[model samples]
Target: MTSADRLWPFLCPSHPDHDDQSLNPVAADAPSLVNLECSRVLVCVAENDLLKERGWLYYQELGRRGWIGVVEIQETQGEDHGFHLYALGNEKAQDMIKRLAAFFNREMPPLL
Candidate 1:
C-alpha cells in the first residue's frame, strides 16, 4: 500500500468544525482554489518515481475542479526522480529543458 493509502487520515485530516488541516497542502486548499485569472499550470512527473502517481493525481484533481486556467502533465518514461538534474547531458534531460522553455514562452490565451 502507498503511504497515502496507509496514512489517509493524517494526510487528509478531518476537523470537527470541518476546517481542513490536511497534511497535503493541495488537499487543504482544493476546495477554495482560485486566482486563475490567466494562469496556467504544468506538472512534470518521472515515470519510475515512487511519487509519480501522486503527481498525476494532483494534476487530474486540479483539472477536474476547473480551478486552474489550464493544467498539463508530462511524463518522462523510464526515468526516476531527479534524473534530469543528475543526468544533465542526457536526451531526456535536454528534452525536459526544451519543454520547460516552450511552456514558459507560450502566450496565454485571452480570458473569456
Candidate 2:
C-alpha cells in the first residue's frame, strides 16, 4: 500500500478513522461481502492501476466464498485505471462494455 492509501488523505480523509474490517470488504470479518444481493460479479482490473491488487483480492475472496453466485476477474494488460473512459472506442474498452452488459443482464444486442 502507498502513503495515500495508508493515510487516505486525497480520496477519503476519514478512512483511517474507520475500522479496517469495515473499510476493506475483503477483510476477514466482512462476511457481508458474500451477502450482497448480486447474483454475479465481474471485477475489471487494469494491469498498472494502483488498485489492481485490491481488485484481485476482492475477486479471489469472493470466489472462495460459498455464496450462491458467480464471481470472476478480468485483467486488462498494459492499461491504467479509467483507460476505458479515456479511450472510449478502443478495443479493450468495447470488450469491457460487452462484458459489463452481460454482467448486468444479457449480452448487448447487435448494433445493426
Lowest summed lDDT over 10 consecutive residues: which window, candidate 2? 14-23
Q: How does model 2 score by TM-score?
A: 0.75
> Which of the numbered candidates is closest to the native, going by highest TM-score?
2
lDDT digits (tens) for residues 29-51 of candidate 2: 56666576667678898988766
Candidate 1 lDDT by residue in tens digits, 37-108: 557878888988766787787677666666757889989999997789998899999999899999999999
What's the lDDT of the predicted structure labeled candidate 1? 0.71
- In candidate 1, which residue ranges exceed 4 Å CA deviation? 3-25, 28-31, 36-38, 110-112
RMSD values, in order shown? 5.0, 6.0
